[model samples]
Target: MKFRLLLSLFIFSIQHLISQTIDKEKLLEYYESQRYADAAQYLQSMYPSDTKDTKSLTQMAYCYMMSGKLPEAEKSYLKVNSIEPENVPVLFSLATINSRRGNKAKARAYLSEIIRLDSLNFNAWKQLAGYGENADERLKYLKKANTLNNTDPDVAYDLSMTYRELKQYPQAYEVLKTAIAADPGNFTLQQAQLPVANQLGKYREVVENGEKLLKENTDANVINEMGQAYFYLKDYQRCAALFKTLEDLGVRNEGTLYFMALSYRELKEYDKAEIYAKKTIDEGISNHTSIYYTALGGIYEQKEQFSNALEAYKRGLTFSSSPTLYYRLGLLYDFNLKQAKNAVNYYNLYLKNKPDPEEKDQIEYAKARIAALTTTKELVKK
Candidate 1:
């Protein structure tokens, strides 16, 4: 029995070698002659069990992918990756397909891992560098790639992000100056260079290009960014005026309203601040409405209207499922309204949301209040 088992394994190994060594010329003929179905059928019969035949698997995956058998193709690629985790070609192919299939996060994860494994992979660096939220990390990778291969303009452009992210104004300005020299009037480089300068607190850069942006691009982003630069330079009146201009010019988005209210708050124009805060809600900007709600509640609290403040906080709770609202409401009830039951209710709600490691003690205190409220209620019923 042992001899038979060993003999069977030997035969299988030989047959697998035979399958893998099948003539490349024949396979190419089958593929080029549009015999995908026949080629697949023959390949499957020859290697009934999956094996580490990279070329054969790649061909089969391509056929499967082209035939719209995406699952089969994906499985084949997974088998390839299992066999060779560090195969740049396999990883790149898989990443490209994942990206095309709209699995951006999955694509990003794969590309990021590949870059981590092989930093000199310029394709991976270039593709991932375009991700807006991850521009900083991507730029780091790109700089490494540029150090490896200096002639690539994409590498230079990508590495320019360090200036923006690190707020290295002069270095960014100098690098961007050189990049623009290399590729004068390239739209992306031109667009990115100014922000790097702005971040570095180069107000002169803003002043120099601000007029050009306003004249050439009436884009809301351009306008908002210019307004922000002015705001940072302590030009509060101009900031408020620009925000008001944006609002008047049909740029009255939530961001515009939020900035306008902030500008007003900074300018000590509390009436205008309240007006914009209320308008932000009226415009149905629900995501950041909590901040505005807290602002309005704070205003009411300052005016000594505890009832209105509490109601505003409660309204904020409805708009946002934020724990901060409940926490503030709890504090208001506990300290100002002298309503322990309401305080307990809000505290419990806050506790439900407060799971941060630093907030464990606060969470415990809130839970105790809730438990106390339950006990008191039971005693009253009795």
Candidate 2:
């Protein structure tokens, strides 16, 4: 009986090898020609999918992936994963597909499994690092990745950037130096080095290195750092010029504008200084105060909270007597609160502000209401 079973198993193995050889030849005709869609079709037709081997399923999945048939690829990979649960390469392929599909949690789970099986797996750790939700979590994963492979340019860049985001400037600077040394012609590494160098008060180094990097397409971060470096070096004229370039690029932020203002002042350009100082305040705070309050009041009005709407408008008047606020207050009192005297007073205040040409309808309404309310008050008194 044992001899019969052994002979039957050998016969089955020989048949399977013959079938696999024929499939491989047919598949290579399409696959070697880079016709992945054709190869996927051929692979899927090889046998009933329910009986296909895991190796054949994996090959089909790879063809599907190359052909941009993500759903088909995912299904094939899933079947392979179930059959060969301990296969690391299959796990990695599953993670890649899930990530491409925006299934971040599933991708992370597969990556976690890879590391559990082989803790020294560098690609799994690096890919897992990006799944972290916060800077601290990202920093922890990135540190692990960086340790596993310090010479990896991408890992070094990400580690340095995470350190910089957390205000660990010295560590950020050090990481980039090692990566840059390994790949000296890397412009991205050079770009990242500027801000940390400036933060560490290495102004001369930032300027000397930054000047060679300036181009039509230089990033705004690099320009901002160069502006700061020039300012600290007391090169006021060049500082103002660099900030002006940022302004032209539409990259002006509050800090850059404030520095621009100071740079102009140091260069004895008072008018430009005043202009930039006003811009700094507008960018930093206060300029949108009235608009913010107006939107808040409108939200309250939408919720049918008339009292809250009135209060929001009144508070906005205290910040800036924006004509729009006066108009809103008048509308709430006139239509909702039934306070004729309060409505009339606010309408008159709104008219006195002489709002813009766009407020012509509002101005006309205010004028007509004031006249009607004043006459009604006299009649009530009588």
Candidate 3:
């Protein structure tokens, strides 16, 4: 009778244990239905302790993450990590959470661990590139990522930009070209190709690629690049037309104004050229102010407005003692204004400043003029 009673008790205990056990499929059904909160609750009730159930713990972490319970998600992920220390997905999740939380150091540590376990992890290398301490480190990681996955447009773009930033123009151009070939309609890669081509002195390529971009989208940046390409090609009319569009669009910065002024000047529209050149000066891009003033002076010289030309050149001198400006002043004073003394002074100033190698001919001419002017002055004094 005692043995039968014990057997009945054991059978009841087994039935109770089976009833209390949670079905993973039921939890998955809740998760798959987008009932993440319900799944989390069910998992919590079933696995109340930090059990060795990595799958359940990972699902719970995902649920916490999807529900915006980041702290809880992090705790659950850590629990999974404790159980499966070399788990790449868990490590990557922890890295993502730390990155989103602005914990860069911790995120980097996690990514480093991932790479240590699986060196071919492209995503881990790409993520690490963002957290690099310097440009060289970033470049290193990006290059590795690119080697692993050259087909990704984002990876190609990033690697190309890194090379461009380091002034490795040829590499940038090559990478961008390969990326464009793979994804021909990628506007970003096409646009990026323009500047690198320009840097490589491939102005014709800029025009070709830039025109292609313009056909698809009338982006202001694409228009500006096309205009620059035209300017370099000496297609002043086309350059001026494109720049006018930019001006009409209210995108008239100092660069656009300078290009517009130069284009008009090349086309001999002196009045319009002077207007844009002076506008460039008013825009206060100090680095190019000297060039604007010089262009304005050249326009006045073309119109034979000698006094205006002189004033413009003098204003330019205040900003930059450019040898070319000095030479222009010497020519204006000597030939047009008939100020031999001032001409001699300017010619002397031009010689004193080290002129560019391309100005060798101009330097020789100045020397001859100075000698003649000084002789004339001596005879006049006598």
Q: All models: lDDT?
A: 0.72, 0.85, 0.86
| TM agreement with the true structure for every prediction | 0.47, 0.80, 0.68
Tens digits of per-residue lDDT for model 1, 146-262: 656654566666677665567556665666676677677565666666677667777666755766766766666666767777777878778778888888888787767877788
Worst 10 residues of 3 by lDDT: 10-19
Clashes of 1: 0
Clashes of each: 0, 0, 0
The candidate maximizing lDDT is 3
Model 3: how far residue 124 lies from native, Å = 0.7
lDDT of 2 by residue, 1-382 (tens): 6754553453344336325444444554575577899977875665566854776678778889999898999899889888888789989998998999999999999999999999989999899999999999999888888888887999999999999889999999999999889888888989999989999999999987787777535778888899999999999999999889989988888999999999999989999999999999878777678889999999999999998998889888776879899988888887788787888889988888868879889999998987887788542553
Q: What TM-score quantifies how close candidate 1 is to the native fold?
A: 0.47
lDDT of 3 by residue, 245-341 (tens): 9999988898999999999999999999999999998775476777888999999999999899999999998888889899999999889988888
| lDDT comparison, 1 vs 3, better candidate | 3
